[model samples]
Target: MENGNGLKIMEKNGLSLNLKLQNGTKVDNGTHWCFRGNKELDTPPEITIRGVLGMLKDSLDPSDPRPTIPLGHGDPSYFPCFRTAEVAEKSIADALHSANFNCYAPTAGLPSARRAVAEHLSADLPYKLIADDVFITVGCTQAIEVALCALARPGANILLPRPGFPIYEARAVYSHLEIRFFDLLPEKGWDVDLNAIEALADENTVAMVIINPGNPCGNVFTYEHLEKVAETARKLGILVISDEVYDHITFGSKPFVPMGVFASIVPVLTLGSISKRWIVPGWRIGWLATNDPNGILKKTRVVDCIKGYLNISVDPTTFNQGALPHILEKTKEDFFQNIINTLEHTSEICYQKLKEIDCITCPHKAEGSMFVMVKLNLGLLEDIKDDMDFCFKLAKEESVIVLPGIVVGLKNWLRISFAIDPCSLEDALGRIKVFCQRHSKQK
Candidate 1:
């Protein structure tokens, strides 16, 4: 018999584990349950990109007449020039109206969507990938979490790139995985210090991660360099996690090479998304692929572990998955090249403009990605304490924004995004120059 409210009370071994409610108050078994969050988890310092950007925005005065120039983050969707391709928008509309994709997607992914991602990635790889080798994620962020959690066994540690994307560090911390930092040499165009990685790894080391056409630093890895990275991971007896979100957008002397190209040497876990290339981050479609041509991931049960994690996790929207095939196939090369050309022009403008400021120095010219990491010469400034101070002051005084390098594990530097229109970039840079001069020690 059901209750008067049409509810059916269930029991598990004489205990429901669910509290009954009466008059909006929970009725307990002579004692109320105290549900609390896990207190054992380590909370990271609240210097995340979003957190810091929020603080900087809060520091701004509303009375200021100038428009806020956002160079702090990499989202370019607000800019008219960086709008996504027309075909991509049409694909989403078509998928929504088709009435065939309103149903729930499989936990792993829609089979055809998985196959399309595999085929797209396999075009650059020697060995083909089956649908089982790919798992769709809400975005690359979720893919990062899945990869980290899968590798987060007891006492297992993961190596991360320094001055890197903060999301990896955040996810690793949340997954309770030990993190070891491997420096990317800014003097060498931000190449990884392989020697440091050698000293950091042991039997417990699970994987090493690299972001190509890197975030924070806009250096693209050469084919030779990537080959060496794969070899190093092989020698260390660890798999490589390559993030190719900025794939094929190179405008440098080097080309964008996928780590899967070297899967023959070692196993690789690749995280990628259409957010960067297609310029539709809001759509939130990404994937994780196990590029284990040697079948090591399968032999070691890593693939099974990843699948298990996906079975209980959130997935990309089904309609987005339905539209993904068209987004990947129908989108022409010309659309991609146009964005590349725009980034090339904007990156050039960023590199040159930073050179004009006395206190800020960009060590390397940006090549592929949307940002450039530059050092802050605090001695040249009068009142600023560090990178954070510089950013806060710039936001308040000049109405321009930039990211503090300390937010990405480096101090006394800044991460400036050049993905805006050329005129806005120039205007923002000019304001930065003025702000620097205003605070100059000589002044």
Candidate 2:
């Protein structure tokens, strides 16, 4: 039978009616479904690490007997040496068995979970944080999303670090926020270029993001440098979104300084998670804490906006949130020390091996995060064209995967992850050295 709007409607016995329309029929395409037709989202300019690495994985020879070595990204859970703490495992198991937290978690997270996160982070901060100041997220990625969404506005722009993590750039693009790049001087141990940041900011600049214990570069900022960053944000009258996902993972002379320490100097939003430190990225528990002691964020309605976003977005798993208190409080200090010790040893091995490779130059030793950003000497190689070409060739020849720097806003550089087992990391670096030697121009 024909309907008033649709050309035809057919009803089958005990089945739902099927509506079929003529080719030229005009139908209501609601705003909710309109985004599906947006071609811009189908092909974003930003390339994700996973997307690039997956492409390399596909190029590997199936007949090769050697196990594929992945030096591409920063997940170390597959290696035995990087096993998560037993206390963390027990905490989650206990939570699951308790039969107390099967329901959906509150949008801002369970009160107990929020309180635990606040207290855990406050231990390192100058001022204490209350549960209300902390909002649990699905993970640090969502925390970043919420922070960017809260700050995004028409005619507003945000400052980002070049040779930095691409997630910030991806989110900025998706949110339609204008992005301005500030340089991180690789020669100066990846420190932020304050002059460039100053030049990038205008009256419309709403926020700036800083990744301490830096991603890809693995350079931890000193206390003095952090203070300067806070001062700069204050001078610009802009908020600071500090990504501290790698907190306490430092294995260097300088201690990890939380930007929250200078929250009183400037309004700050600190995004963090137990993923890196606890070795539980799959657990997906993270938080965004408003670190303003003077209530600047609250007064500016930023906090309200964050809460509003959380209200509509999906919450973290309830049982996982239930496990947080025990995981944060009971995990022994020795466990953390062991992780730092292993990373320090592996980083040293990676640095020494890369130093031997004539086609690669690591500017600074990795001190905190799992990665080291090394400049690729393409001029020294006969065949390789750029970082992407080098990575593709490396993967095909040796079944070794690495992330090209172009994905992270830098071309002709490579990001190497050394968080795997020391033996595996050594073998992987050996394969890389062999591959580079085979393709050297002098060869």
Candidate 3:
């Protein structure tokens, strides 16, 4: 027998049962339950750099003897050459031993930790910052999320750089903020195309993000250029979110300039962390500071939004927060200098090695951050299809890992991390050269 709608039915003692075969067709068993039904959870293509790299890693040969050289991301703590300072490690150990900070931290952060971050960041700016202006986050990643959430409103838009960090795009999309892209002119040392930025902004544009000592490009902005960006934001009546997570890691002639220096001209949200500088990304301690000496952010209630969000969000690890004061106050300058020196040496080696490869061209030598964006000469390689194909082939054949530029919104280019040990970096580049030579069309 069959019930309504041709469902097979059975009845006993006035109870009816409807059964359907578990075929590949959609079956409503009093609920629409299917593993593939929810499209909302599906990840969009090219949305995350990690996801793309993970796919390439899965395709790597199991029989390969050489250890995988990760030139993909900016993590180098695994290498002995990039270890964190002893003082930072000692501070965390001391905090743990004291047993004073195991409890939950305050919503914004621990008062002492916030104050320490304020003081540390204030040292670089003309104006001073109080603890109230600093909010501790899990890492710069959360700092970015909180900032975007605070700024996003219905029918509002934001400006981002092209060939930029994918996190900004991912967060903006998740927050329902309309994103408009402006170009970073590669021919001009990857400077922000100010004219495009001006054209992209409308009255509905809420904010613009600038990643100084840029993430994928490794180009640092000069003070004059930052001044123009500030001016542009002020004229647009929009806020500036300065991602300075890689602060002061410069190797080239241009010194690292914090976008907060121009906060007097426009309201700026400065995001920073000890991750890159201290070489301890796993610590999960970072801050978002409002650099508005004029109280513009407070006046607009953007500060209130951030606090409200933080009130419901998880704070960074308490013991790590307890260690911040010591980390900021006692870490020797020589420790920082050593990191810069090592990065400078590794970057030069990578650049010189890359220059010798006939199929790749580096537009500019890496100046600040741990990455360099190089244009891949796909035409010179007969078998490789695109950046994705190139990366897969390189990983499978050479046991090397590098980020495809398509993940960063630039096709036919590559973002290489030179932050590994100098010897490993040299070896990886050499392997890349060999791979390119092996696939060269000339042969």
Candidate 4:
């Protein structure tokens, strides 16, 4: 190809290579070689939690002496206060030292780990779960991706929650699965907008996703609410993709109810992980269970599809799998309760401190998960244009990172993680309050 300067540019795989002449000598015109990025991956960077967190971290001021307070994403393992149980660490060590799990694990995962997860989750269910019902995943992240792939079809769509996890949309869009959002009523403890679901679904809709003890909202769904959800899915002839990654970490009045409880009413694909409850996200042990008591998933070939996908995918470590039974069976209740108590402390701190800021409005208290979604009153701030602007400026000036709510399908809002130390949580919110005051219209 010829450029404006009349030098020939070589091409490879539809991208411009370095300039060269007929004699094969590289031209010195200083035109750098470049390539295009995948169009499918563009949506993920703008919406994913990790992408936003990385952007916020880059906006930090190098000259600032204070430490960066990360309130953006919900990985609390960074804090010393939220370490995993000793038994969990010991289990992995013992498995590794045994040298029995050095080889690659089965693509679907080791049978023992699968059975352990099945039995562990079965405790909360109305019926028993066999090992075949569960497919171990690298993490809940992979579980969601594989689940979406299994459901994706030509001219198909899925219903999602507003202010929901962006990974659902990212993976869906990547797989060419259409997305239809139904709001979660913040006014009613972020309950599913059943009317909206009824209106949005059609023959092409396959399933609806529900994150109980939610991610950004952190409001646990009541048994009655989940029952209504099951009824709605049944009426629509669709399944429920229940994301219970934050299971049993609840500190709210309403108890944590497994969507598997309603597997008899409708097919529920329940996704869970050791990430949140055990505070070991880096451990990367998770499961995707077909909680259909009637065998609808197997009948529909959905379980087969999931297995096919996992066949080509990477498995969690063999040693981790070998240790999972001990980890699940031996970990004491105190370790779990300690996490809940710490989260409760930080949640209260987030609620009270967010109240002190005029520009931020938190609709519901965080009762389960590490995050709480708050609406941004952009009108109250003199210079802040939107949630992204507020977060970027906050990161640059205060060294505090927060997530823009638009990434999670809500505009003019922010999602904050209260999963850090209590002191750090208070300090970060205090900085946010000062930032708001400094940028206030009255100021």
Q: Over the stretch 10-109, how does candidate 3's per-residue lDDT look in tens digits?
A: 6767966545534433445355335453343357655588898887788788899988999999888989989999999999999999999999999899
TM-score of 1: 0.91
> Candidate 2: which stretches are off by over 4 Å?
1-36, 44-46
RMSD of each: 8.4, 5.9, 4.4, 4.5
lDDT by residue (1-443, candidate 2, tens digit) is 87676556555785545444564333332212222344436654338887898889998988889999999989999888999999999999999999999998889999999999999999999999999999999889999999999998998999999888888988888888999999999888899999888999999999999998899899999999989999999999998999999998999999999999999999999999999999989999999999999999999999999999998999999999999999999999999999999999999999999998998999999999899999998888988889999999999999999999999889999999999998888999999999998998873
Candidate structures ordered by lDDT, highest first: 4, 3, 2, 1
Question: Each prediction's TM-score against the native?
Answer: 0.91, 0.92, 0.93, 0.92
lDDT of 4: 0.92
Candidate 3, poorest ten consecutive residues by summed lDDT? 21-30
Please report, as a residue range, the 10-residue window in candidate 1 with the lowest summed lDDT: 18-27
The per-model lDDT (C-alpha) reads 0.89, 0.91, 0.91, 0.92
Give Cα distance to truth, residue 317, candidate 4, Å.
0.9
Indicate which candidate wins on lDDT. 4
Rank the models by TM-score, top first.
3, 4, 2, 1
Q: After superposition, how far is residue 29 of candidate 2 from its true place, in Å?
A: 19
Angstrom error of the Cα, residue 167, model 2: value is: 1.1
Q: What TM-score number comes out for model 3?
A: 0.93
